[model samples]
Target: MNFKYVSYLWDEAKAKSLGNNQVDLLIYRSNLLGADLRLTNYGGGNTSCKTTEKHPLTNEPTEVMWVKGSGGDLGTLKKSGLAALYMDRLLDLKKIYRGLQYEDEMVELFNHCIYDLNSKAPSIDTPLHAFLPFKHIDHLHPDAVIAIAASKDGKAINQELFEGKLGWVDWQRPGFDLGLKLADCLAQNPDIKGIILGQHGLFTWGDEAYSSYLNTLEVIEKASEYLASNEGKRRPVFGGVKIQALEKEQRLTQASKLAPILRGLCSSYQQMVGHFTDDERVLQFVNSNDLDKLAPLGTSCPDHFLRTKIRPLVLELAPDEDITDYKKIKEKLIPAFEEYRKGYTAYYEQCKHPNSPKIRDTNPVVILWKGVGMFTFAKDKQTARVASEFYINAINVMRGAEAISEYISLALQEAFNIEYWLLEEAKLQRMPKEKPLSRKVALITGSAGGIGKAIAKKFVQEGACVVLCDNDADRLKGAEEEFEKTYGKDSFSSNVVDVTDNQSIAKLYQTACLAFGGVDIIVNSAGISISRTIEETKESEWDLMYDILVKGQFLISQQGVEILRKQGLGGDIVNIVSKNALVSGPNNAGYGSAKAAQLHLSRLLAAELGKDKIRVNSVNPDAVIADSKIWAGAWAEGRAKAYGVTVEELPKFYASRTLLNEIILPEDIANGVFACVGGLLNKSTGNVINVDGGLAAAFVR
Candidate 1:
């Protein structure tokens, strides 16, 4: 809302218009907006501008819009940082809204205007911009406006305050219909300067860039002023309901019921919104009368559905209720949620048109009526931030509108119609997947020696940041030093991790995500050996082997896959399996079973993650002597002694047993990991690649 910053950005964006194909401006705007986004946390909005110019070589005119892509906030939008969008096509598609079927047709229509083939789908609200009559548009759900929107009669209240100053639309399901509605509104009010989408957000425009940008501040200030001067009688009768008085027991009960479903839908929402209740102002607001009415305004924008789903939780508290029974309270709340889900299903079925996609889940985005405040869910930090902002603003806007008349929601069926509407779903399902990580971050576990170290080095050679993790801290440190000295680039990092511990694995992934933005490739090369027959293998040894191989792989893969889902980039995970997994190995029940479990886990993950563009596969290597720590250890050494051969001769003995008599090095296994990157084997996930030196007849079964 700062005029100076807006002016500065407008000038800079105008200045950066001379180049063909540059991401600098897009990145700059993303950071600028990102700051505002982080501060407001949930109501952070974005902007984009379209321009058409003649190509220098072809003499043909192409269009591009400077869009605010992922990864940056809007409070600090800079020129050269917005995503360059093809403009003419966007404009062309903007005019074609006829005869489109639901999901499939919608997805097919979205393909008409393509931006970066390397990034995820364009923002869900891109369609909003597609129909904007203006070249430059700024959208936001500032807290000042949202606080008013949260009221029970938000629509009526906002209408009275703005009173002919802004164009208002009841919250339409924000897609093609919203765009068409906006286009109609613009047509009616040739002089209609700005638009305020009820229960949704604010859209500002300009003939000259600054006019629209400045208008946003001007209109928001007007609404803020109206609320300031006419806030009505200060109802302090509920002042006795202090933060401590808002049952600590009831709060936990509500969180438990809502967290899992919300978490499953969008994993990061609980963490972000939970922090607000800790603040005194938010807690006081929740304790006040406004709490009950404002809890169900939904999100400030439709896209918020992606993060927080649709609604937040509402909890009803009685003055004398014993607040100490948290667990008992949660037990009772489950049935209420079940009832809500049932009601929701009926609503969806009744209201949805024949052209909508089937509902994906029964969970409500928001919780209500149980003495608990709202909770938003999201897949990542950014999504959660957006959800919280939208929730906060919608509440404020609802409150402001309540002074005039009753607030109206689109009929449940209509909402269901919009939510499950095929066109809307197709936008998400048909998005083209990209592989930027063919050159991004690579994480190699057990990278001190063998295939792990090779993969780690391979990533470094191919323009990627590498993290080397292993149980042997010293060797990992050594590899780190060698990487730093050899390349003299600070592109390699190391972590000493015991992957068997769930907590440790979680922390390791957190570290990886924080340090390198995100992890794109994960190679599990850490394993253990007992080398005893089933009866001879001690219980303790069997436990240790399973812990290192099966449990370690499970935890590591889980953590890695979660982070990859959030990064919005194509991700790859490679498991190091033994040929023994495919063919039974003698005296190796525990090890074989554990490895087989790992292979199966990889396959399952591949299926689950294919939608997320994450690939999971394993390399099955046989008789590789390059980094055979098992052979150097007690069991293999003892076996060598018993066979009357030195430890060095063990390599020859294993190689001669193979059909080709060839020795495979750790580097060979590393190459298999590298192949998974760059999208080279994109279509080949779930299958195990044989990286053995050719041993057929001797294969144990």
Candidate 2:
């Protein structure tokens, strides 16, 4: 809760902006507050500053409030992310506003108050910030503050803790009405430094940005200290025999078995990626004896309702039974999800208004599996990660609140109002157009490096939930970290699997099914290259080549077909063959024979699985030496000797050999893979599309 405001960072921001003090200071302070997870999570808080800017065409000075716009995280917020709304226009709405009847209309009026036409829509809470009289305002749902704000006796306790420095506003859904109520409270108590919104969040403001940010820190710190002092005395303790902690290996094994089943049930009809976490804190909370009492008490704050529903769906488990048993896990997960869905439907019916938007999908955003930790579902990785973080924070807040008194969240009606509010729903409607492969789950083998990694990256960009499989565990871990950073932790996951083994291939498919419901596309990209003549090729060399290049494709594609059949959805399987499959090169009998066999296997599978609507295709790529693990050691030396060139000159020689004289890169191969999987050739399968930069020998007939 300590203020981390650095003067040099603020000075540097102002210097970089050429003396736009308001915006630079706002950005600096927003980042400082956002950097602390205790204060606010990613995109959970907002900061605003009042400034005057001249109208572009009219050249008249107009007062504007630059508030944090929707979809921008305060942690990395920039000037452009703060939408400029005409302060006078927003204030004018208050005069004409009637009662709380026209919530949707009020949101529209706020949108119309924008001073800068090109800026994104202002945050839904813009009116709340505007209604305040301070020049700078900060709002955050800090855990410590929410702990005090969400207690059963929150008002009385806050009155005592904060004294006269803070005012309390009863839980009111965010809208024009709530803004007016907040404004009235502040007006009545002009000496109050901040206001605590019951079951929502905390708001602090000052004439300057630093003061507002620091005031928030100060208030939250005080609340945190209050909770610390009352913890042992007031915290509720449940009496039950403590469950023995499972070994790490045992826990992971059980989780791996149940993760897919839970994932499949949650994503039944919808496309969602489930991010699993077994962190010690999550395990401690889920395994607590008091979980049945505390887990379903509701979200820590209203804002979190948008990410995690009002209540998490907690699955029951037997204490002494084996949790890793698939049948046992499946039996518990399926019925639990069904019951949770029915409950959500009933809850929606009870709380929804006549004009409210259609109910959201019944799938729970946060799932508390019996023996497993938490599993958060989202359309993408970053969102899932954000939800997981928020839920973890909520757990802490609820624990703290229980320490003081009973934890009490807003009533169900208020939660529904926030969840289905026009402003909140608009965020989803405002998302950019989805790509062709959006929400589809894709499994890519050999994803540790080379063309497989490139394919994984492309699928992620197209909005596919990707599963990366490789035999090299270390490389797979590295790829997972790299992709998680680039695409998001939810977008792709890495699994170690030897594609040559049937069991390994089956496990890979199961991982994909659990991680992202089921697979929509499978790219068999794992292979090895051996340049040896028929006379010189040893039996071991030949067998190894066939095991990886030919048999591996057969195993993975077969398993993928089974998963697709179960889902009753047509899918695509693209094999990464090579130009050597069609046009045999000198001293490449071992490699060429295996690839040629793989190409034929793809055609055979296509002919058989097409009845199930499973399309099979192959991309024959040539000499993609860059980052190719297959092109190292003996393969590199042999290829250079075959071309009568040095190792360094091999790439140039291969490029010159092509009719287009182009050097094929891994991304070029990935493009061909995307073409096959993205429905470009939906009706045409059992085809080999050459990605060899126009090699006539490798052209399809």
Candidate 3:
């Protein structure tokens, strides 16, 4: 239980050698203890350290809390590789937890802590660091300890193993309260070597990094040994079948494809590691006539719905036996997946509150065929390793535990409570909602205007592979040049589209969806306006305007919603309506009426799609400075001449009408569109935001 065992980790951190990223420390340590902690089958645990820096001249220091951004493992932590945050801001958030219940507080506080802040919110254990007095912290739910925790009398077993040695806390949610509980317990037990969270995981720390780490392992080993000696010997359940070797290359290929989706399902998979083995237990289990019955027991834990879902994939081919090649394997597997998903959805619908975020996917992470050993998926090799280690250890432990007593999982509703519990969902939302528009190919009809180009640029900035469309080829080419110059080459495409034509809109949406996996977001910022008072307006003029403005908007929103709702993302549709819709400015009947109609359309869609979490928002600008072809052509110069002002003055003329007295740029409107994604407005639907630099006309109820 001394620091001697992990001094190397301390040395690495001291020398600034772990990595330039925050997770470097955790990743490094996880790797070091992989075999012992099984924290990572290959490399799983992730760690981060936070520090603040001051601006030299202002002397008004900006506090930055750097965290591992996206990648790395806890076994290692370093500098230069973390996302930066304002420390004071995070510290202030600790106040929100004061009187709120743990469950309620977790969601609000977690969202606030990570909300659009510089870094990903610290791990679920971040509140622990905030609560602890130590400068270094380590969190690992190692397989060895989980082996003990998952047992029938886990709490009793832990009490016996660490009597008067380690601090203990009943499992609470993992963030701040968990931290608070551990901190309080540790305070009472000053001489405690470490702490073990009941039924969840382990925590260890010391004044020095190495000492804290080794203490974690020493305790786990103690638990492992205690369990081994106390449990009576039992017959091998795995003795039923003969063992055979599994093929490495073939399994690896299959594992690779499943790993990404699996890893996305569970944070545990980040430390994935692989070993080709034909252990008798695994072989016997796979070859058993009742293999299907045993399949569900192999998941790392019952709570892995976030990553591995609830079901397990069955592989019939043994590792050593020759495999049958068939594309229909996936085809056949799809139905089973559908069945699993239906069960999950029904379970959630039965138990969840009206507003709970719906279950999005029910895909399994591990494939255990009758013959093939098992395949685990993860975000990286380290994640895969972690999932494998946890699952493998659990399977072994559960088998033994079943001999002692029956094993039952928490109810599906209970699992759902834990899964969609606000705190966890807050974390999911706090991380930049996956760039909605990024991966989806999009078709922007009016590509040559300020709003259209702004939305297009927004998608491109988020890494979406884009397809740009406009009626004029030359103007499309010009918009493409500006877009590429701004976003980098090949990120956008030019397509000639007559958006009023239904055939064209359908083709464009299909093209974009197929090209980019699936269309996630669509911005219908294309429209036309002819200013005429009621007396001056004509039937033909109104028809043409409706064909593009009202009709085009209707077509795009309808098509976009259909694709999005079907995909289960409930995708986003951003309409560029005029501020005149809110406060009509003595405009022509066609423009004003069409804009008003579109506003109601957006509102109706919002109400209908709320169930799907498909968000619909409108960005209504007072008057934008156009960079699109609409402005570059005859319209801009004509408007300028009519106003007796130069084209440059047109922007300022619009700027003066706003209360803010600030000029609105394309980027300003761009910000409005960007804010519509995942953050700032998870609950916002069918809302219109004014990007008018303080214009009162765009204000809406």
* Candidate-wise lDDT, in order: 0.60, 0.80, 0.57
lDDT of each residue in 249-337, candidate 3, tens digit only = 45444333332222222222122222222345555666654355555543334334344444556644434332122233334445655
| Quality of model 3 by C-alpha lDDT | 0.57
| Per-model TM values vs. the true structure | 0.53, 0.87, 0.48
Candidate 1's TM-score: 0.53
Error of 1 at 240 (Å): 8.2
Point out where model 3 deviates above 4 Å: 1-37, 41-72, 80-120, 187-190, 227-232, 237-294, 297-305, 315-335, 376-390, 393-411, 421-701
lDDT of 1 by residue, 314-409 (tens): 544452345344345445555655665676677667776665677565655543333444454332223333455555544444444443333443
For residue 689, what is the lDDT in candidate 2?
A: 87
Q: Which candidate is the best by TM-score?
A: 2
Candidate 1 or 2, higher lDDT? 2
In order of TM-score, best first, we have 2, 1, 3
- Model 3 worst lDDT window (10 residues): 266-275
Which candidate leads in lDDT? 2
lDDT per residue as tens, model 2, 1-701 = 23332111234454456455787788888887888788887888788999888977799998889888877888888888888899999999978787888755777787778887877677668888999988899998888888888888889999888888899998887778888999999999999999999888889998877677667778888888888788768543322324554676555555555555565566676766566676766776777776787777778587687788888887676533464445556665677888888989998999998878888789888877555577787776567767888888888777778778878867888788888876677777878887878767889899999999999888888778889999989888889889877876668766799988887776676566455656778999998888877788899999999899888888888777766665556789999998888896899888998888989999999999889888999999999998888887689998888878999998899999889999999999999999988867889889998999899888868
